[model samples]
Target: MELKKNPKANVGRNSSLYFAVGLNVMLLLTYLGLEHKTYETETVKADILMMTEQLEEDIPITTINIPPPPPPPKQLVTEVITVVEDVEEVEETFVESSEVGQDDIIEERVVSVEEVEVVEVEEDVEVPFAVIERVPQFPGCKGNNAELKACFQEKMQEHLQKHFRYPPTAAELDIQGKVFVFFLIDKYGKVAKIQTRGPNELLETEAERIISLLPKMEPGKQRNKPVGVPYSIPINFKLQEQ
Candidate 1:
């Protein structure tokens, strides 16, 4: 009546059921532990965020005072002047007497107003342009009247071409025009009285900058006397198509 199979053979059949139950129990415990830890971490994060949001509630609002800007200064206004033509010329003569007499009383004579220097306000004075007698010599220009004048013109043109620059703003806006600049070569051959007329102020500014870079040169002369020579040249600002 006892079992015919070995006892260990039946024991192996129950071993599989025991292993499956233990593995399922272990997995369930690991899942529960991970869920507990995740809940604790979320609780801590929520508390930190809530504390940050409530922190501003306990603080008081503040106001600051700002100063106002200063007032603008007043501008001076000049009076307009009217010009008049000269119609009369008076001559003044200064005569000294050499005869001295003790009985003679020297009477004072009214002096003529012609000897006095009268200054008139002028808007613009036309400076002379030097010609054959003597002409303005640009730096590095040498030779006779014809040679010097030709060299000067060549150098000036070269200078303008070398320093030609197109304003970035003007280029971006696609505006191109010719600028005419008038500058004076004074008695000392120094550039002065620079004036520019152009379609745009930016173009004029560049033209003036090119002329201002001129080196000190031999002054222009008229009848062997140093004089101011007004010179004018045109500069073209053009942008090429891409």
Candidate 2:
């Protein structure tokens, strides 16, 4: 069996067109709705400026009477006379010429030995340890120049070891460094001009204290003459590991 329908009666044939038309209309409506904008309007009022005519009052010019300035005062002229007193006369002293003439007689005066003063000046000479003819002798140290030098070093080390004491403050702060001490042995075999350079004042003070305890020794000699000796030594301050 075959079913026949009229050409105008076909609903599916116009359904696609109707759907496209409806879709297009819906899209247009959506676009218009999305594109629509509303702006708020505020009313402004304008005012007109009116120029009003003003009346000007006439001001009268008043005259003021002022008296002229008083006349200048008159000055009187007076004469002055001065008198000077007489000054006393002074005598001029004559100076003799320092040049001596061959014909001039010179008096002979005897100068006694006791009448003339003799001044003796002692010179301060400093000699280096290496170049000194005789180095300062430490107590209980005796030898030749080379041997004396070695003995002195050994004795110095012994002395340092005997008196080495770390500063309590420096140790607490963990301060460690090498202190360079420069001291001068005077001609009288006494230590002087002791200076120290270290990382901290405590270390320097300790080093100075140790150096100050050094026993008096024989003064250094240069050319068989006693002289001040300048010596430098280094003291190491180190912390032992636990």
Candidate 3:
């Protein structure tokens, strides 16, 4: 015995359609809610002021006293011109042509070497210390080229140590740096043309002074001839830590 149910009474048959309809209605409601706008009424404040009568007062007119325009700048004769006769006559100078014409006589004479004055100009030649064949010999320094160079340096150091005096102001102000002293040992073995560069002028001056105290030495030679030798040394101005 099988029993048959009515197809129109099935509940789950329209469930999908009902869900789609409900979802569409929820989306429409959400859109409407989001798009809803409310307007608020604001009360305006009014201030009323009463009119008052204004009184008019007359302002006094004041006159400014100005000095009558400086008496027009007085007119006066500043200069007077007078004609004077010429007293002294100026001699007229005649310019002669320097170009030689065919009529001008030219004297020809033979020149002899003995009659010609030969001026021997001593050339001032400079050679660097490192490349010079013979380095400048310090006082009491005698040796070959290399030994002389070493001795010269040793003597220079001794001279600097003997005369090294720090400027009191520089030491007090705490100025310390290395000063490069460049000096030329002239062909006559005299230290000359001393130049210095340093962080401060005081240090440079002191370095210059120390180099100036060096004794006259034998000039450096290049190719068996004395030449001015340029030497550079650095003097360090350092203060001892307390």
Model 2, span 76-116: residue lDDT tens: 88888888777988899999998899999999999999999
- What ranges in model 3 sit over 4 Å off? 1-102, 110-114
Q: Compute each candidate's TM-score over C-alphas.
A: 0.48, 0.54, 0.56
Rank ordering of all candidates by TM-score, starting from the highest: 3, 2, 1
lDDT of candidate 1 over 115-155, digit per residue (tens)? 88999874333345544356788777788887887898899
User: What residue runs in model 1 are displaced by over 4 Å at the alpha carbon?
Assistant: 1-132
Worst 10 residues of 3 by lDDT: 66-75
Clashing pairs in 2: none
**Which candidate tops TM-score?**
3
Answer with 1 or 3, whichever has the higher lDDT: 3
Best by lDDT: 3
lDDT of 3: 0.94
Q: How close is candidate 2 to the true structure, as a TM-score?
A: 0.54
Candidate 2 — which residues are off by over 4 angstroms?
1-115
Summed over model 3, clashes come to 0
What tens digits encode model 3's per-residue C-alpha lDDT throughout 140-173? 8887999999999898899889999999999999
